[model samples]
Target: MSTKTKVPKQPLSEQLSVGIPDAGMFEDIPKIRRVAGDSAGPRMKGKVVIVTGANSLQGIGRASAHQYAHNGAKAVFICDYSDNHLETHKRELNSLYPDVDIHPRQFDASNEAAVKAVCEEAIQKYGRLDVYFANAGIATGAVFTDIDSAEFMTMMRVNVLSVFLGAKYAAKAMLLTSPSKPHPSGSIIGTASVAGLRSNAGSTPYSASKAAVVSLMQTISYQLAGTGIRANAICPGVIETGMTSLMYEAARARGTEKKIGQLNPLKRGAVADEVARVALFLGSEESSYVNGQAWAVCGGLSAGHPFVPGRLS
Candidate 1:
């Protein structure tokens, strides 16, 4: 069955509308924000970026794609293997931002040939590649004993292998940036999960795959030592994307929607664009020194166990 059949209409336009400036800039300061200005301008202006798993209207990839364009990317390539709304999303972004180029394609990020072709096409069409975000992943819930082997393996390919393949091609492409540059520079990011950082938070296969992605980024960072390409991962908490809509629906149906993220310190889940902003930061020059780490955007869910001081055994 297609995942699209299970998906509901999304608020992508509304999310993007409020998050990134429609035609302005975003400043990166110590929590001190700014409006459009020379000092605080589009972070991705003139850069070519690609975001995989962008078909879902409300997924992190979609939000990142719009944010990238809103910030002035010369070209943004996005794709998804299952999203039925691929063309619709591409057209929407183009219609909203006439100056920014948005190319939406359909392909499986886990396939080697497909991944290579996407990278090649981006370079051929856009002239160069500056950032690659391997954000395609799936989550499944099942007891360890009940999970099938094939399901586990597929999760690994979707989450872990996709990251590897994207990084492999992104690093090679970033090396071709203007030779005059003193050092290599490009970003390779993947979406991990707070579940990957700890146990008992997510199902077996999903957690394993996400954990591998975190490790993959750390190892890739070392592999691309002098290439100027940085590797990192984003571990998000519960966000109501299509991937987790089933979970959200269950909570809503049970009159427990308000408790969805109550386990975290902030006591609220994040929006897709919130995670996209972090992606924007990692891809921009502001994160020049950030690399090889899994940054959690989970409202402090993974900070520590919620042990009350006097209640401890």
Candidate 2:
């Protein structure tokens, strides 16, 4: 609701031109022919992927599942703690991609047994687990000193431990099953946040839990090396998801809405799809050599200080 506009230090086009080659030079090259927009690349074709926390209407999990299905994944297993909402998301996805297989299951990501059972169920139904996005997370707003022990434990169990259980079970399933003769084996992606990278005022428990996700990803990547299972974390900035929406609303209620998106160099917030694309890239073979990395899809918000209008010359 706050209309404060913070201009970025540099524009996207300028940044893109600096790093990438001119497309005109490759326009006439036979190897550079552009595929039709409607075509599904073989990158994820026939693969089975599981995504957690996909039931939320404005979360990255839903967006990632849709992208995976659109990219020709054979089956997309959606797991969430909410049965009714999960069914709704499953119905929507199935309606959108009638030919694609969409499997919806009710399970709590924080529960180790539930996580393991879901992984096994997906493998039994789909034959193999190719991609797993451990995206289920919870956020709580509390000052570091005043935070209750129980609240801290809940955040850790849901945000950090859930990722650990997901990676453990998903990797176990992937190791037991062999990959397609030509395609690579498997990938595990965890969703961290900018909070994990930097301190967040009044969000100590949430930030600490997200930080744990980064550590979990690094440890999992190292442990899964040589097993054809790559692990990575997607560190998204303030996207306009259900969780952030609540935060924004709370800020508005407290007359502090102007602080939203203030830390990002990019003045505006990102949509869920922006983060989902990075998840897809990490889950696909295009990033075959990319492992143990935290890909930040933050619209350059994390690049530098935001240029406030009156504060700057």
- List clash counts for every candidate, in order: 1, 1
lDDT tens readout by residue for model 2, 196-258: 876642288888888889888987777765566789999998788888887777888999866
TM-score per prediction, in order, is 0.84, 0.81
Instruction: State in Å the error of residue 31, model 2.
Output: 10
lDDT of each: 0.83, 0.79
lDDT of 1: 0.83
Query: Tens digit of lDDT per residue, candidate 1, span 34-147?
Result: 322342888988889989999997899999999899989889988899768888998898998889888887888999898898888877876578899999998888888998
Candidate 1, clashing residue pairs?
184-228
Please tell me which predicted candidate would have the highest lDDT against the true structure: 1
Q: Which ten residues in a row have the lowest lDDT in candidate 2?
A: 8-17
Model 2: CA > 4 A from native: 1-42, 178-184, 247-262, 305-313
